[model samples]
Target chain A: MFQTRLEETAAQVAAHLTHVLDGYPAHPVTDAMRYAVQGGKRLRAFLVMESAALHGVDPQQAMQAAAAVEALHAYSLVHDDLPCMDDDDLRRGLPTVHVKWDEATGVLVGDALQTLAFELLAAEQTHNNADVRVALVASLARASGAHGMVLGQAQDIAAETAGRPLTLEEITALQANKTGALICWSAEAGAVLGQADPTPLRTYATALGLAFQIADDILDVEGDAAKAGKRLQKDADAGKATFVSLLGLDGAKQRAKTLVLEAEAALSPYGDAAENLREAARFVISREN
Target chain B: MFQTRLEETAAQVAAHLTHVLDGYPAHPVTDAMRYAVQGGKRLRAFLVMESAALHGVDPQQAMQAAAAVEALHAYSLVHDDLPCMDDDDLRRGLPTVHVKWDEATGVLVGDALQTLAFELLAAEQTHNNADVRVALVASLARASGAHGMVLGQAQDIAAETAGRPLTLEEITALQANKTGALICWSAEAGAVLGQADPTPLRTYATALGLAFQIADDILDVEGDAAKAGKRLQKDADAGKATFVSLLGLDGAKQRAKTLVLEAEAALSPYGDAAENLREAARFVISREN
Candidate 1:
């Protein structure tokens, strides 16, 4: 059920992104922007849709935010894959943006995609109420800016240069900003749209985000390259500290499982309405990628 | 008077930016972001504040929008100066962000600064009305995204690699999107905040923007490098087409003067109340830098 829903959202978000890109002038940058947004797992988009469904927000209304998050996520990946950054040549089974086009196109594509995310959120088509849209934009900027994703990325780079393995506690704090901030934003987006208290969903997303990172660490250790659609065990080669390194593989898996349960329990207030979200937590720890 | 007011707004905007960035984690990225934003002309921020004053918006309320445009402009410069883009070494007579820091820090600092721009615009302190803030965000996205600044930049890169100079008409359209979009946005932001018609300010900004670019082209041809605070004659050196190349230097100067008059005339609707904006148009074509 979770797999089917995730794929469905992925297709819808892809179509929406294509439609949006089509409106811009035909140029290499626009072409690269279109290419860059393709083929992610769309877990962030699915989180947005499922959380919105739980809050009784219309899927059409929620779709805008879903596409926004995916576009924003794509921008981050393109820049992250730059030679000056991670220097990765491949991502999602294809050459990364800088490798496929040039670095200039990669930079502009990422910059424009970030702008497009805020554009989507600010449009009236996203919501009838201006307050909701403003709130959404403000929260997203907070999640993606210096205090959140960027801060986490900076810390990771600093750690690499420092030539020391991060303590388990320090890595936890870093991941909470890097990957966890956007995940929490995706989960709580529905409540923001519906103007409801988001405490429960926030709690649910916090655990889910941590588990998701741990699962990623586990995949880095034991996952197949073909299944993951990218390089594997690169962290181990770099001597970077990861959940699998700090905790034993078995211990990391146990922690992810426990966090999944905590995530499911946090959704108890909505009962069966959150079954899909519960399933999503299980899928997080179990998925190959 | 224009110089005094521009400097005043520059100092205030810098201080506000510092306070906002200080709230984030202390890291290399944040430090680079702070460095990247310093020492600009602050013309965009001045336009925002000056236009806001014309619409009777309070200076305190207008300061948020002023800081937002400056941040956005700063982001564009950091990215544009990257080796993958223009590869500029000097800006405002200082080393470019990538030259001062590493490429990765340059990328991250630019990314964070762009997010900061939207964050400033969406804050409740920018305006009491949510509708006004949303409008500012939407217009800014349009001005800065693929449809505007990015499109112009891509065209520029393509022109350079195509091994031909752009036609007079083509360069005009490119500059309209490149430099003109943000100037227009800054000029009309006050009207947007006051919920008044922006048509007149838009007209004024259109001419002012063109005159400003023409002046830049003229500066490249004849102005002192030390006064310009960056390398001059790069276009002539590259054999790139510019207004001064297409038009004789004298012709370009005359054209800028005509546009400044048009910019000034567009403010007739506000009578003496718009004196500073009128002076701004004159200043655009006359400033050394």
Candidate 2:
């Protein structure tokens, strides 16, 4: 049931994105923008949709917010892959934006995609209430800005230059800010739209986000580069600290499992209706990619 | 009056920025963000404030929008100066963000700053009506995204790589989308806040934006590096087609003057109360640096 629903949500979000990106004047940056946003797992989209559904928010209205998070996620990946940052050549088995085009195009595409995220969220159709739209915009800005993902990026960069690996607590905080911020936003978005208490979803996302990062660390250490669609073991190569390094592989696996349990527990208030969300939490720690 | 008001506006915007930036964790990227945003002429900020004033919006409310535009502008400049882009070492007499910090910091700061711009505008203090805030966010996104400044930037880069100069009409259109989009947004912002018809301010900004770009072109030809505080004449040196290249130096000056006149004329709807805006148009054409 979860798999079918997740796949359905991804398709719907992708179609909506195609519609939104339609009619861009065919320049390389525009082309690159489209290309960069094309393929992501859309886990964020599924989270948004599932959470919104759990809260009785119309999925039609939820799709835009879903697309917005995916777009924002795509922008982060594009920028993260730039030579000045991670310097990866491939994303999802294809050339990264800078690799396919030029560094300039990568920068502009990421910038433009970020702008498009806000644009989508601010559209009136996304929500009937203006306050809701504004809330989405403001919260998203906080989630993605200097205080959020960018801050985490800065911390990661600073850690690299400091000639030392971070402690376990530091890595946890870093990942929480970096990957977890957007995940929290994605999970909480439906409640934001529905004007319900975000506490449960927020709790679910906290554990889910941390579990997701641990899974990535596990994948980096043991997963195939082809499956991951980018370089693997980059943290080890850069002498960076990660859950797999701080906690033993087995220990990391155990911790991720525990997080999944916590995430599942957070959804108990929604009863069996949140079955997909519980499945999602389990999937985070278990997915190879 | 215009000079004092502009200075006052810059100071107020600066102070507000300082407050917004107050609690950021002391880090290189945060420090670089402050440095990069500092010391620009604040022309866009002034425009936002003055236009909001024209609509009788509260100065306190108006300052956030002003700061938002300036933050957005700062982000544009930072990314534009990267090695893959314009690669300038200096900006406003200080080392560019990349030079002062590192390429990673430059990219992150710009990304964060752009996020901060939307965050500031979406703040409840920035407007009373949620719809007004949403309008500001949407308009800004359009102005700054693939359709607007980024499109213009991509065109400029493509023109350089094409190994041929753009025609006069092409450059005009490019500049309109690039500089004019943001300028138009800044000018029309007050009208958006006031819920007034933005026709006249839109017209005023169209001419002002073109005149500003023309002045930039003129400065590229004749302004001193010392006063300009960045490399000058790079356009002429690269054989890039500019207003001065398309029109003779005298013709470029004449064209800028005409634009100033047109810009001033568009302010007639506001009568003598728009004297500062008129002077702004004149200043665009006449300022040396």
Candidate 3:
């Protein structure tokens, strides 16, 4: 039942994004923008809506925040697949923007998407106070920028072609900045839109973020390429550090289970109000892909 | 005399930025961040401060805005100078970030600095009103994003390698997005911080931004290589469109003078309240490097 609702919200968010992005001038850059944002798993947007629902926030209001987060996620993917980064040719079973266009267009499209995220958030009329918008902007900026995802990416690149192996703690820190930050921000920003105190939301989101990464690592190790929709075990081949590397398969699975439990525990204070979010947390770890 | 003050303010802003940025963790990414932002003409910073002075805004308050603009400008330059874009080796007499570090570091540093700009504005205690910070963030995002500078850059790259001569109007539109948008944003943001209505400020800044680009074109045509700090006449060599290409050298010079006049006229309503900004307009055309 939750999966069906998640798919519906994901489709709605993508449809809205398509409408907002379609109005750009018909330049190669604008075309690249469409290419980068037009398709995705929409996982981040789902997390935002589900978490917002947990706080009794209107799903419609949460949709704006969800779309913004998804835009940022798309922008990161566009840049990440560049020749200088992962150099991947495929994302979501489609040609990466850099492959479809050129590197320059890919870079610009990513940049535009990042800015578009802020523009969407800024245009939100549902939030009556400018303070709410400011906080949301700050949340998104930190999650997407250097002190967060960018920094994590830098560490990941640095870890590559280096002689030394990264410690377990270092690996966790890197993932926390790169992947965990945005995941956490999506939930926290949704709570902000719900007018909930951000402290508990952040705490809940952090555990969920770790669980998300562990699940991703597990998928890369055991999931089929057709099911995952992209290359699997690329991280292992690249010598990129992961929980699977440090914890082994059984230990990693145990750790992921522990994280999901802790994430659910963090939402206990909200009781039945957070039922959707709790269910989402369970699905995050249990999904095959 | 005004040149001396501009230099002094640039130095002060640079010093403050250095101090603030040093507080980050000293990783390679952090070092790249420091290197990318450490030195520049600080033209945008100067414009912000000068515009604030014209409006009788406090110098100290103006400096905050100036620093924020400089950070954004520096971030753009770092990204612009990457192997994927202009591929320049030198900036302000030092090796560019990509040359000094790697391309990934360059990319990450640019992302970090861009975030730092908003973080600086958001953390400013002087800007007590949340609405003001929100406006600043929104304006910066719009100017820097796909619809603005990034889009401009995408078009510039596409046009440059397309092997066709672009029309005069097309070239101007490109420059308006690439160079003019950020320059106008700098001046208008200053005016906004000074609590002045931005409509007139934007009008003045837009004219000045175009004028500034024309001056840059003229310099590229006739300026000395040593003084200009980079290659000269490369635009013509690369077959890149410019005002000088569309309008012959004499015609371009005449258009530049006309633009300066129009820019000055935009500020006329403010009378003496816009003296410093008006002087800066004259200074732009007269600058040798």
Candidate 3 collision pairs:
none
DockQ of each: 0.90, 0.87, 0.66
Which residue pairs show backbone clashes in model 1? none
**Model 3 C-alpha lDDT per residue in residues B63-168, reported as the tens digit of each score:** 7777877887888888888888888888877889889987877777877777777766665443777788778877888788877888788778878778888888
Consecutive 10-residue window with the lowest summed lDDT within model 1 chain B: B155-164
Compared with the true structure, what per-residue lDDT tens digits does model 1 show for residues A1-289?
A: 8789999999999999999999988888999999988997898899899989988898998999999999999999999999899888889999998998999999999999999999999999889999999999999999998889988988888888787899999999999999999999999998898889888899999999999999999999999999898899989999999999999999999999999999999999989999989999999999998
Query: TM-score of the candidate numbered 2?
Result: 0.99
> How much of the true contact map at the interface does candidate 1 reproduce, as a fraction?
0.86
Per residue, candidate 2 scores C-alpha lDDT tens digits across A1-289 of 9889888987898888878888667777877877887776799999999989988998888999998999899999999999999898999989999989989999999999999999999998799999999999999999988888999888887788777789999999889889999999999999999999999999999999999999999999999988788889889888888999899999999999999999999999999999999999998877767
Q: Candidate 3 on A1-289: residue-level lDDT in tens?
A: 6788778987899887878777766787776777777665677888888777777777777787888888888888888888888888988888898888878777778777877887777665536677888788877777867678888888888888677778889988988998999989987876788777877667778988888888999999998887776889998887777889889999999998998888888887788777777778888888877
Error of 1 at A128 (Å): 0.4
Error (Å) of candidate 1 at residue A164 is: 1.2
Clashing pairs in 2: none
Q: Each candidate: what lDDT?
A: 0.93, 0.91, 0.80
